[model samples]
Target chain A: MKHCLILGAHSDVALAIAHQLAKEGHSLWLAARRFQDLEPIQKDLEIRYGVPVACFAFDAEKPESHQAFVEALPECPDEVYLVFGYLGPHPGSLEHPTDARRIVQVNFAGAVSVLQALALAMQKRGKGAIAGISSVAGERGRKSNFLYGSAKAGLSAYLDGLRNYGYHHGFHVCTVKPGFIRTAMTAGMDLPKPLTASPEQVAKATISGLRKKKGRVYVLPIWRWIMCLIRNIPDSMFRKKQL
Target chain B: MSPFKQSISNWGNYPLTESLVYQGKERPASGPYIARGMGRCYGDSASQAQIWSSRANRCMLDFDSNTGVLTAEAGLTLDEILQTFVPRAWFLPVTPGTKFVSLGGAFASDIHGKNHHGNGCFSDHVLWIDLENAEGEVLRCSREKNQELFELTAGGMGLTGIILRVALQLHPIETAYIKQRSIRCRNLQETLEQILAHQHWTHSVAWIDCLAPGKAMGRSILLLGEHAKANELPEKYQNQALKPHSTQQKNFPFFLPGFALNSFSVKTFNFLYYHKHLPKQKEQLVHYEPFFYPLDAIGHWNRIYGKRGFTQYQFVLPPDQVDGLIKIIETIRAHGMGSFLTVLKLFGPQKENYLRFPKEGFTLAMDFPLSPKLEGFLSQLDALVLKHGGRVYLTKDLRMPPEMLMASYPQAEQFRQKIKEMDSKATFQSLQSQRLDLHL
Candidate 1:
């Protein structure tokens, strides 16, 4: 069994991943902004799967403390999952600098800070794997949610670079781009029924990608072609239509 | 988060209503709200104009393997509990027909199961509950503490208050499989006799052929079960004796055509089902999933009844009312309303609770497809049941008249008064409560 560390343990997707990993007999280290929220989850996984689970306080918005948090882990994890993200209100984030900064800091910059420390530690140990959750919205910017999309686009680019770095070393990194997910994050939104994937489905795809050591993974295979079609749309024509 | 407007229906998918659905993490501060969980109650017991869903509140607060006592949020479904605990050799003391019902919903309905002849209802195993009163105050209740309130909320429906958390006693099991014995009965009399003969069995129920005529009327297959010992299982299953059943459920996908379940089709299905046993007696080792919840194997099985939906009419008559039971079955056959699913069970003496349905009698539940004539036919059955001193199960009811509820449940008025004393403003309400005029 591997020691897997999950960074945003409070999200629905993260919890699903934790359950999947625990069911496979993996020990877990769960960290989230509100660590208290992880108490019940920790107990549940431990009892249900007969695995060891530890929870710690983590603030994804605070990049300065990322390194310290990584160093303080009970032990270095065999695998790390970057699952934290923020989707700010559309027009509100566009108008307010605070909101826009939070969207970027949590989804992009904070991930880089933590991964840098984790990569250094894994490099010294000579082997590790990292999987980061990106978004399909990053493939092409849309007026509906471009701010969140841009931050994810940055994360996807960063992971591509990180994958190259991992190739030089003995470790591996996988970037996961999920389309619309049915989670607390997208609860009431009128998402297309057939395209929306449940958190459990995303968790299964993530685990499968990790096992295969693939560089890039899409939760729903169809999302890859959907993103491809969206990316090919000409900006001249796309700018006039509502997404 | 703002509450969104949507049309909500229970498992029955009938009598749909527009409601403001809320799924916030914290309890919303509002008046006249009802807590809904999984919406598996089969009727309007969980639907309301303002629905406060406990789906987001699911979590296990505490568990003691030594004592098999579990403390969990009210929204946790029995299915989740079984998945988490059964592998560890722990099981629910009592479970309803479907594992999809939430802990709070089970408590509100005081659901009984095949083991009711011995273990009693769900509330009997509950140690204590943390209830959020209408005043938005959380109170700890148990038989020893806040005794009166405990009795009031046992089957009080959501009218008492919102159930926040519950501490329940879980039973121990040696394996996840059950040693089952299926007995084919010729008619209603033989079915009841076989059920009585198998009183020592932990779980017992009969599948009755509701459309069977005269001499063959109420022909059924009585199933008696006991948790299988590891040694009782075959060599193939012995190694993984405690492994929980992994079911790959198939969805019905969409509603079938309205005429899909006509009397002729139902009769043929029942005939095949009854004859499938071949011999008078058969025994085998089976998984708990099929033993406890056969219909759950087919997801959205309700859609098989078609878009108009169906209602499960369940009622229990006094032990001496055998003639009444026979007449009721005969009446359904006469109407040619062919109930596709008919279940019969014997219940032990019931405890004194506000609105619990179980009693010391035979309870039969039948599902009928909705039609214009259904209401009128059911009303006839209702009058017949009331005449025989039987009460319809409120959880499965979508259209029982208010007077029938009062006549059936003698303590209903006292339960309503207790709600007034607790909420004062009648802050919690449900479509069932309103239809029965339970609100002050």
Candidate 2:
């Protein structure tokens, strides 16, 4: 059985990943913001899959705690998943400095920090996989959600560079760009059913792609086709849209 | 000399190109190796070796216009043959989607074309293959000498060795247009019955509409065809035309940016395609190019997926898994990501190749433009297929789990045993092999 360490395990997507990996016979360490918040999921995963699983608090927002979390692990996980993000307020992001900083720190700065520390550890071990959940909103800057989108955009680019870096370094990095998912984070927004995907859908895609060691993948593959059409709109035509 | 390694990124854009370097022989040094054909195959069945290597390695060995038999170096291309022999009133006995593929590739892929219902695959017409086994001796494989390898290589994707030359059977035709009959089936069952009932026709293919949910799912357009006789042509063209030919061609220079193929565009295209061939169930004379390869008319067609190439998912369901096929389509529709192009074909009888994929079942091929929902859809489909005793086509699969693949292909152990005994050092390999963990 493979061993999996899920960073930012508090997110609905991270829990789903843990559940799926455990079902596939992978032992798990589901790390999150509050160790207590993970107890229910940890119990459910272990009970349903009959696999060993544990939970630990991992505050990705804190840079100093990153190394200690790794040092305390029972063993280096075969795969490390980075799924933390702060969609922070769109209106507040424009006028408030802290909102913007929080969005950047949580999405790009912290995720990268943890990835670097973990990737170095993985490199020395000679094998491991790093998967990060990025957003399709990062495909291009949008007037409505540029702050969250921009952070994700940076993370996506960073993952690409990491992928190239890991090519011969004995490990792999996969960047996941999901279109729009209906999660607690997206609880209040109005989303089109046809366009939005579920957290389970996103989780399944991310782990399956992880197994394949694919360079990068869009969870719902047709999004590749959908994005293809959207990206081709002439600039003059695109500048006037609300989409 | 050393074996060359080159990274291939895109699919079907560059001219059947591959980098080549010679690895010195270990055993008595067999004959020189030649480039295998198009690589459309699933196994390593058609390979052989040549003493000389160069661009001129390809040669037209023989042609009997009367009986329509042609023999050429395995390196010769289907397009080249079509150009040379089509004008002379002869055409390939069988053809897949595009003509740009090589004869060796066709045999390797053991390709089946629009007429598979009426004709079998390329193996049905393949006369012989010039093979050079591991021992470095040239062995002519047919239904005779080295018959097992010949049968294995017919649909084999050149895994055994190199194919030096091929002898093929060509078909005689009076014109380049086909008298086609188009029928719209309300669903898959009707479509299958129609194809079986019309099996006497020379060609048959169906464009299945996989997006429709529930009662409307699996709707399709069935096309039946036969080469047009001279008298069937329009009077204007028939008066001076001893032979008819295609006169239209279009090209797409580069991959359009991603986001160009959204639901709106795909839905519109599907609607137009469905209605254009609808209600009117009759026959008409049409050019063969559009009939055989409407997609090929546009170049770099795969570029439509943009920089991130897409994978074509094809699977076959045994008779018992018929309901499973419906579920697979429904799952995609439920996910709101219907594939742009999906095809369903019924394969009759089974070939002898132990590793052959089409084993007496109905097969469906769909092009899934990459997306997040894709993984979930494929995973669910993979499990359902495994439960129903179905298998995915390895040639078109890029992300199947090794465990699932092992279970799906009962012959996996046999294939492993063969590879272990024949190529223990693992000299022949590919991205697919690595992805599926099909290597030692």
Candidate 3:
């Protein structure tokens, strides 16, 4: 029952965290779209740390499969990570309603559909910790990627409410907001190098936050101050200035 | 999106060129690909267009506890292997000066080490190799199976085929420590004599003072070592004999200033180093990490050679060419191009089936920083070496002309024939392979 379950385990951050956690001697259940895809990661964690690792197939859009994925686990997890995410849009998605909807469906609605069940199971046991990888883009609706940002914003709010719910239910929920990481999702982008955090750094801070039961965490830790400055900006001055 | 393009070079930092480096997580075993490991070679052996980086493919496939035979992906680094296996009383059969190199690179380079006098190159212990030919079909090759392919791929420099995985025979060690003795050789003759006389020693090498003139022409500090048996360890390390090799690795954060590491400073450093051993305190218990890989302790130490980069000229002279070897050393002294690290070692018999760098000979490896006149001087040295039936190590070479390559490798044509048979279209090719016409 003290196992670590990683949903959307194919994400770069999830894989990094899996290495960190498995090194610290935790049994792992990695659930991704294709269990076969996670086979290599599963084998590595199992061999490198001499720990047990299980891989499962679960699509975020296919909500009905979530419960079976959880039940199929060798044991219920005490620590859960919901790292499923998508950053995509059809060309000219700004004007196309379908593309925007798909973005929200994958990021917000899809995550909530699964996390809701996980949060309930943990609430029933009166104990557990769940760390969800949110993003700094959620802090404000950036015009460049607001569709993706809006979904993260909605997910962060849900985490806030869930943390309050877990407060009484004897569980912990951590909202990990990473500013930038060089991951599969962000490859080929000419991102500001100095501001970007590596996947290892994000995993480390998130794990630290989970250990301390911190309600909100920022990767690189500097994003905490940056987001604070952005959040408190007055609408009059903020709207007039480019981010 | 298009592949990531970057100007990457070997660890020497020489001849930097743009490459469409594959940055994906998947291994590029199939399709047109050339396997590029840590790029530790001093030359273009690891550089090519469509460079398939072996970064993501370092999974340990299997390990036979009974025989200590470990099956691992080509991408796995020697450092990673040592970290995992040292505690289990297993060590690599042969490792180059650095642990940063990958298994794939090791197989391709067919590297020899201090133990070459006894064990031979890295491929001697490699039992089988899984190669994806140009047609994208994986073939299991070994000495008993596709014997010729195995031998060709061993020192094939990633030209014959791309290595996907290899099963290596590991040397068992009682402790991660080596019982070592330093024999300080006074000059060129003594250095050769010292290395030659140490046949009883399991591992041996010398650090020569390249600038030392006259009686001190080849003054060197020779090191001979044997893996410490359990009984030989001190009281503190008795129970920890099989513990992992650990060190506090210090790193050079950036390229050192161009003016640093010049002739005078290096000579002074070598002088101080040679005297530090001084016959009195020759014996010591050392962890294999520092003994085998002193440069690895200082990460990115190659950057100290400056942006222009450096070239390493390592040649093996047949036993009868003692006079020729000494002449080569004297010529280097006359040139005054100045060398930084000069190592002298005696190599044993050639054991690999196809292509191998070492035979029964004396090997001299030296590093010289890039200078305008240095290339001309080296070419002259290469000619002298060629006359003596000596050959420069291809892995350490950056600028050997194609003619010199053909003259150096007797098996070059045979290797070419085998490569042509396997990779007719030459899908797997490196900058070095193309330059030397290995795909003929």
Candidate 4:
């Protein structure tokens, strides 16, 4: 049996992955913004799938608390999953510098801080898998959500660097790029049906990739070709279009 | 997620509408809400207006081994429960034809299975329900506490309140297999006789070839089953009391073009199906899954009906109203339109305060494609059903006249009164409630 530490665990993706992991009989530590809200999910996993689960209050924005959160956990985890991302209101979100910074910080900078603290300990322990949920949107900058995309892009690059470091340290670092998941965050987004996946689907794919030691994988994998095609477009043509 | 404008349809793809949808793993913070579970209702019972999907709310609460009770979140699918419990030598006391339905969907619809004659609706096995009313207050309802609310929510079409969790009693079984037998019936009369003769069986249902005409009308294959004990199985397999069977499914892919399932094609299909079971009676031991829900084998079988989608009209007539039942068959034959999948089942006496669709007689369910002509045809069927003192299954009905709804379910008026009292502010609302004018 494995032990997993789920960061930003309140989100549906994180909880779904937790459920999947719990089904495999893994002990879990669920950290989110509120311990009260996480209680139900913790109890659910424990009862339904029969796994040991503990939840704690976690704030991704509080960088100082990252190291302590990891060290203070009751048990060390064999795997750490990062599933925290924030894409605020659609229109004029970037106009506020603090709001824009928060989005970037929560989605990327803060995640890096927390993972770094955990990674150092895992490096010494010499066996663990670190999985972070980056997005297909991070493949290229778009007019609609470039701020969020840029943060994910940075996270993806960080995971890339971590993967190389992991290979040498005998641990696994996996970067997951999901495309258009039908989560609470994307509920009303009028996304294309063929492209959108449920959280369970994404979690299953994410877990399977980590299990297989696939350093980087797309949820549907079709997004890989889609992103490849987009990356190849001429700079001039891409600049003229608004996507 | 905050609510957004999205268009969602029921299992029947017709009459799609734009609504405020909040699809999340947790209940939204505030407001009156309609809980949607898998959106599997053939009609708008699970959709319409501000919809809060139960997809994310699935959690198993508790299981009592001694009592054989399993308590789970409303969003837990029957398939998931069966997967978990069947290997433990337990099975759902009652299950609808599909495994995709959520526990709450089953509870709210009070869905029945082939064994309704032996058992009852899904609620018969339910120990209690946790309902969240319009004010967002959770109330525990059962036969003892908040009994009125319990009666109203079960088969209330999700109008009363959101079913948060349900504690259900499961039937202990010796093995995960069904001892099934099939009997061929020539027409409606013979079908009824066969079904009645098999009342002692644990499970009984019939598949009618609706396209058959004249003397061959209502030709069907009546099937009955009992749980196969380990000793009852063949010598080679007797030791394995609970072994997992394959749940491999084949998707239907894209919708077949509109012309794919017309009368002629359906007739050919029905004729072949009717003749396929040549023997008058045949016995076989098969897995419980195929015996109960054959359509589930083909994932997205509803897609076969094409983009326009189809509507299922299911109603039960009193056993004495044989003429009314035959008239309904004749009405379908007169139109020369084929309902490819028609099912006939016997229902026992109505359980008190359930708002149950079934009565102490026979229920006939048939699907029809939505078209301009369909509305008028359904009205005729509704009128016929109303005249027979039978009510259409609200969970299955997409288009039954408002007046006919009143005529069919007389208990509905009292139900509406209780709904108004519970949701005094009239916050909880759904497409079915509005269509039926349930508020009054």
Angstrom error of the Cα, residue B104, model 3: value is: 1.0
Arranged by TM-score, best first: 1, 3, 4, 2
Tens-digit lDDT track for model 1 on B159-236? 888888999999999999999999999999999989898999999999999999989999999999999987788999
lDDT per residue (tens digit) for residues B336-409 in model 4: 77678889999988764635687778999988877779888888888888888888898887777677776777
Local accuracy of candidate 2 as per-residue lDDT tens digits, B203-302: 8878888776567688888888899887778986575333433435567778867698776676677767888885659788877777787776776678
Give the Å shift of residue B416 in candidate 4: 2.3
Q: Which residue segments of model 3 deviate by more than 4 Å?
A: A89-92, A95-102, A184-193, A232-243, B23-33, B352-355
lDDT to native, each model: 0.89, 0.71, 0.83, 0.84
Better of 1 and 3 by DockQ: 1
Model 2 C-alpha lDDT per residue in residues A153-242, reported as the tens digit of each score = 899999999989988898899999888887655643567777788888889889888889888889888788887887788878887887
Residue A177, model 4: lDDT of: 90
**Can you tell me the DockQ of model 3?**
0.39
DockQ each: 0.49, 0.01, 0.39, 0.51
Better of 1 and 2 by TM-score: 1
* TM-score of each model, in listed order: 0.97, 0.58, 0.94, 0.92
DockQ category of candidate 3:
acceptable
Which one wins on TM-score? 1
Q: Cα RMSDs of all predictions?
A: 1.7, 24.2, 2.5, 2.9
